[model samples]
Target: MYCKNCGSALDNNAAVCIHCGVPNGHGERFCSNCGAEVAPGAAVCMACGYSLSAQKVAAPGAKSKMTAGLLGIFLGAFGVHNFYLGYKGKAIAQLLITLLSCFMLSEVSAIWGLIEGIMLLSGSINTDADGNPLGD
Candidate 1:
């Protein structure tokens, strides 16, 4: 096999690159299939036709749907849940609408956040800011 981090040859069983100390498929410097240097953000290697980007792999510490849902339900007026989910813009808007207006229209923001919370718990809003699916 090859080390995607450094384009160095690797034992098939190796978990990380000896040269770069990065886990397999962690870096974008070289094509893992052919050891050709590729653009940092290039999707595929022109020389060897190897796809440089890793396929969507589930992460070990994906966010929790339940936690996000509860946060949205309880503290959505402050946009806490949206911030936790990485929807910074939405979070700021909700927070401002409630805080800046001195709670005059907090119900509007609260209901909006409550619905989002329900959506999150119901699997309708499943992805995080990076588009990674939330964990159960």
Candidate 2:
């Protein structure tokens, strides 16, 4: 691996470059795959033929933690927070648990959602289903 900002060699698991302070995947001066200096705003690296624009990610959503927490706290029985966070399976499960049981089991879902909401607010659950970091 290489530091994208300075073209310095880096460990594969490094989050930031040691030589340069830039985050591992945040720079444009160097090619991430080959550590070759790339032209400014170049779409492809000429040295090793690598795509510069593409990022290794699972579809970041930039979701807000506050909104998700509030939803989980207020409408957790309906799985609104989970739905907002892109956890469709969990949301549907909570919704079904509340509806199919005729609201008798609503507290179960509510408590579950409430716990998850608290976790989110506390930064324990920092990422959404797509592994995107939640915004403050």
Candidate 3:
């Protein structure tokens, strides 16, 4: 790993940069993969071809945390949040739990959604189907 703030080499488990005191994966001055200086507006590392695009920098689709949280809170019984996050199988299961049971066991699905919603809001569930970090 490398310090995003200082371009300094980093231990994989490092939480902060020893040279700059900045958190890891927080800087934009250099390439984390190659430690090469990256110019503003450059989409990738000219030397190593490491993509510097939004997906690379911000975790692919950048799923919205707020949207997922709200869906989990409001339509969780229908697995709305799971669907939004691309967990299709799990989402379908939740949806069926409520729909197939004709609401008799809706509480089960609702509680499940509620817990997941809380997890999303609390950063416990922070990635989407593509392993993208949820956007704030």
Give each model a TM-score.
0.58, 0.57, 0.58
Give the range where candidate 2 is weakest over 10 consecutive residues by summed lDDT.
52-61
lDDT for 90 (candidate 3)? 84
Best by lDDT: 2
Q: Arrange candidates by lDDT, descending.
A: 2, 1, 3
Candidate 3 has a TM-score of 0.58
Top TM-score hit: 3
Better of 1 and 3 by TM-score: 3
Clashing pairs in 1: none
Model 2 agreement with the true structure over 5-60: per-residue lDDT tens digits: 99999999998899978887887899989999998666568999896745632244
Runs off by more than 4 Å, candidate 2: 1-61
Model 3: which residue pairs collide? 4-27
The regions of model 1 sitting more than 4 angstroms off are 1-58
Report model 1's TM-score to 2 decimal places.
0.58
Candidate 3, residues 30-115: lDDT per residue as tens digits? 87788888875455677787765544445545788788987898889999999999999989999999999999988998999988
Q: Provide the overall lDDT of each model, using Cα atoms, as 2-decimal numbers.
A: 0.83, 0.86, 0.81
